[model samples]
Target: MLHSEFYLFEEEKPLRCTVRNYQENDFQELIAIQSECFPPPFPDELWWNVEQLSSHLIHFPEGAICVEVNGELAGSLTCLRISYDPAHPHHTWEEITDNGYISTHDENGNALYVVDISIRPKFRKLGLGKLLMQNAYYVVIELGLDRLLGGGRMPGYKKYAENLSPEEYLKHALSGKLKDPVITFLLRCARTPVTILPHYLEDEESLNHAVLMEWKNPFK
Candidate 1:
């Protein structure tokens, strides 16, 4: 399990921030967060259900956590353990995460695979997403894992799909020629781009493609 409490100063006011494991009571808020973050075209059916959340708490509580700002639930980061092989890292999000149930979590896995990192719309722009990611990194260290891995959506890709291939789009995003909301954020978090994952998810804006990214554990 991972738990941390800290503070963030915004406009000279202190905001109490706490990161803790998911409790059964926070279920409703977690569901609302998905509705606010992923709207139409992003299948509503993909939202987390009680069963998946239950599996997270049961399978790996250390990999499931939420952030609260001033006593309000603000964001969450859900993950699962996996023995990853860099040489053969190709896999869909559903396949790797067992369609978000995370039943595939391996107790002896070498890497922490992040299934999702979501922030409440109103709580965004407050660095909570990054904060959630930082906590996940801590989970990696605490669990003695080798790295953090995830498939990040290139939400800005569809805008250039007619003119650029997914690989070219990723290269441009990495080179700072263009900014992709998800890819850029991952880069800022110090994650290295591995490759483009075509048909990674049913994301229209991402053209169903995601950029596989990883942050090797420095302490490992």
Candidate 2:
């Protein structure tokens, strides 16, 4: 039931939004959200599956969280703990996340690496993405992790690929001369850019590159 007639709910009445850890029953809706958020050309195989979702629950349940509006799933943020190496920080999403299964979750790791954050189409513009991210910050604090990290996509880069190198494009985007959908959003969420990683993922728009960002825990 790819792109099925689901999550098309009315928001006329007052809403009750709650953020909570992932549960076994939430997997189906989570998969549906993935399909809607990342359509074709986004590599269907990269979407979360039962095996990977189950692994999140078994290995790092606290790092898997979802936001619900009026009892319906609106968005989610899945992460894994890792002993991040600042000296050699270059790594692809596949290598870091164990191909999205997060089977390599390090319980005593120094950082919480965000594997994915997806918001439903209808739920956009409601600040759910930032809300999920803020909760991730709490996760870092509660677990005493040093920081939060992610390889952010730059979906807007393809538009300027012919004229600008990835680094140049990022410089412009950072300076407010241009805006990258993923990169800009992360910046607004208080994540600081660390470096640009080539071949970080299979994203065509990002030219297979990603911007590695971090949000250090103030409490650390």
Candidate 3:
């Protein structure tokens, strides 16, 4: 699909931004934005290197996207197609992504697996994350896929990790009682939690756990 045809919906303020596919020239800004979004140890295990980023563009050109606001890289969402089976177990981010290289991308797969979504710290809270997710949903529909899947890190859950399990924290977040800045927004967006993936990442923020979430395409 064309970049102009990807994000069909507009935000309230209509961020004067251009959402498009990743280009080779975007490498430096992309890495800068990623580093700003996740600093220190957080990015140590998550940020993609030059080769990995290049591989994404080469392997899944259409699935990797970025949002440019005022000539600056605001945010990006990287994903790839995968054939999934609900009867079988879901794979961890490392397993599915080949440790972030996206070597496992399957063009003929029926599900869109989100590898990463990063927004510059200054650009966050401006509905960019939701915008990125909406674009992913559009990709799913465009590809005639069944659903979108990914491991959602609960950055806020680390505060309660000593008391609540990831599952319990998810219940509270989904119950509309206690709100998690990330998971709550995702749940509100119609993404359902399937299971808790332990040791999903080395990031200390999520206590190394992540919620496996899925957004089934209602149009399918």
TM, every model: 0.98, 0.93, 0.91
Q: What does candidate 2's lDDT look like per residue over 30-126, in tens digits?
A: 9999999988778898789999999999888888899888788998999999999899889999999999999889988999999999999988877
| Ranking of predictions according to TM-score | 1, 2, 3
lDDT values of the candidates? 0.91, 0.89, 0.83
Query: Evaluated with TM-score, which candidate comes out highest?
Result: 1
Winner by lDDT:
1
Clashing pairs in 3: none
What are the per-residue Cα lDDT tens digits for candidate 1 across 1-220? 5678889977788899999998889988898898889999899999989888988999998888999999999988899999999999889999999999999999999999999999998888789888888888888888888999999998899999999999999989879899988899999998998988888998999989998999998987
- Name the candidate, 1 or 2, with the larger lDDT value: 1
Which pairs in model 2 have colliding backbones? none
Q: Per-residue lDDT for 7-84 in model 3, tens only?
A: 322455444577899888989888888788788758664777889899998889888899877667888999999999
- lDDT, model 1, position 77: 89
Better of 1 and 2 by TM-score: 1
